[model samples]
Target: MAHSQTEEESDKMGQFDWFGSIGATPEAVRVLNDQPILFTILLIVLVAIILQCVLLWYIHYATLKPEQKVKKEKKKPAKK
Candidate 1:
């Protein structure tokens, strides 16, 4: 027995355009599809590098001591 699609299913299928509906051009989608593994690796590396830099900056900033101002005492003149 063969199953048939209903009107709603047909309409939903008709409205689907893989690239256009997702807002990406066909060429962009094609490129991503072709190099999915490479893109995934690059994205992971980029995020790791960014996180490392942020953590390093936070550590450095946390270890820093704010400078304190030194107040000098006024010298009084001795009376003869």
Candidate 2:
């Protein structure tokens, strides 16, 4: 069976550009494509760092110590 020129061109066009068009730079895309393992590890590390920061903030603010709670209550003026 023989394929038409347009069909062949269309097939070629359908191939994904490893370097995406507008958002990601070609160099960044190439690095990600080339080193998927490194990318995954880095992504995981970034997420863990973000989660750690959020967890620390939550621990500090969401669950106040008894002494800190007393200080906050003392700071607020009582309504007449």
Candidate 3:
């Protein structure tokens, strides 16, 4: 007699395959599943740091002195 597929096995293969498809290791996926809150906080902190850096750069750029443009004088036409 042939062995039957279990519902749990079918569900695991259908949805969770994406983790492996995306190159996430089993351990990493397990960690993410196990501690989503910790990872969420860590992600928020990382984004905040990046945003702070970007704002600082924008501030520095905005405070820079404007470049002075030289005006060109048009030459007068010679007398006929």
Residue-pair clashes per candidate, as listed? Answer: 0, 0, 0
Give a tens-digit lDDT track for model 2, residues 1-80: 89997577445532223446767665576566666686679889999999999999998887997767655435677799
- lDDT by residue (tens digit), candidate 1, 1-80: 65465544334532223655669775565566666776678789999999999999888877777653345889999899
Looking at model 2, report the run of 10 residues with the lowest lDDT sum. 10-19
- For model 3, where is the 10-residue window of minimal lDDT? 8-17
The most accurate candidate by lDDT is 3
Q: Could you arrange the candidates by TM-score from highest to lowest?
A: 3, 2, 1
Give the alpha carbon lDDT tens digit for every residue of 3-76 in model 3: 45555543554333466668988666656666678667988999999999999988887787766334588999
Alpha-carbon RMSD of each model: 11.9, 6.9, 7.4
Candidate 3 scores a C-alpha RMSD against the true structure in Å of: 7.4
**Per-prediction TM-score, please?**
0.43, 0.46, 0.54
Q: What is the C-alpha lDDT of each candidate?
A: 0.66, 0.68, 0.70
Please report the candidate that would top TM-score against the real structure: 3
